[model samples]
Target: MKEIPEFQTERLFLRGITLEDTSSYQKHFVDYEVVRYLADHVPWPYPENGIEEFLKEYILPNQAMSLWMWGIFLKEKPTEVIGAIELCRKGKPENRGFWLGRKFWGKGLMTEAVAPITDYAFTKLGFEKLIFANAVGNIGSRRVKEKSGAKLIGTEPAKFVDPKFTEHELWELTKEDWSKP
Candidate 1:
């Protein structure tokens, strides 16, 4: 079995998800405010069985692929998971997804965590571009993507269960855009 790599940023440690972090992660997932803007699949009142399903079926089997889901920890409290970030493979390019507890919002922590991972995707992983998207009214998330240099491409109307929603905006960034000197 392959071991997932751990990464360090200026203020956060991006480490692989362990069996230990299930509870902490569930705390954030259960918050309606947090999952509101996420993809249609991440159900609100996140299923009690969801975390285990994620670990055994989704995360463990996909360990070999470029896709990885990480638990984001504060540098001072390295073992405590405060949020999550994942680089998901979406056909030709990769997609970026993240969430921080409501308390950590507006602190530039997400931006700090995203930059190195953005660099890792284009530089180390040999990917040409990265993509991000959020529900149309989700300005905070859009700001994080923009801060990382992703351009607003267009808006698309889509459907999601769980919370039962629709409509979203799309954004994207190329490695070339991020690599400019």
Candidate 2:
């Protein structure tokens, strides 16, 4: 089993998820604005049971060379959960996903949150590439990927099943690209 690694940024700490994050998960997952572009498998108003199921079944088991889901916390208030970020491996490459409470949006927190995880996945997990996709209209997310040094790999239509109709845009970054800055 891979142990939880705490990654520090100037103002935040990226740490492993705990049962205590249920409220944070509930807060964001239930929001329509947040889930509108998320994959079909993520249930709306996510079930209480599902939270525990994710931690035990998917997250805990895949930590070694695969999935790593983390709780984003403010450095001064380490116990409080601001949001969640996940680095999931597909074959040998990892992809990114994240959610921030509505209040945290437009604050550059996601950009801060993603960098260290990308670093850890490439530098520590030995992954050479990372990718992230978004509903084509989601310019905010695209900007985050661009700011993280990921290049636009063009859009893929209907690539993800959205309960509400939406198109997805795929983006990618490699270790060589990230190591530049």
The candidate that wins on TM-score is 1
lDDT at position 122, candidate 1: 86
Worst 10 residues of 1 by lDDT: 158-167
Estimate, for each residue in 44-124, the C-alpha lDDT of model 2 and write its tens digit: 666668867877777778875567888998899887788888887673222778887777789888888888888888988
**What does candidate 1's lDDT look like per residue over 1-181, in tens digits?**
3466788877889888876888887776667777776777667567787987787787867864857777899999887788988888773222877889888899888888787777877887777877777777778888887777788888877654334547667777898677321
- What is the TM-score of each predicted model, taking all chains together? 0.89, 0.86
The predictions' CA RMSDs to the true structure, in order, are 2.5, 2.5
Candidate 1 segments whose C-alpha is farther than 4 A from its true place: 91-94, 160-165, 179-181
lDDT of each: 0.76, 0.76
- Model 1 residue 148 lDDT? 70
Candidate 2 weakest lDDT stretch, 10 residues: 156-165
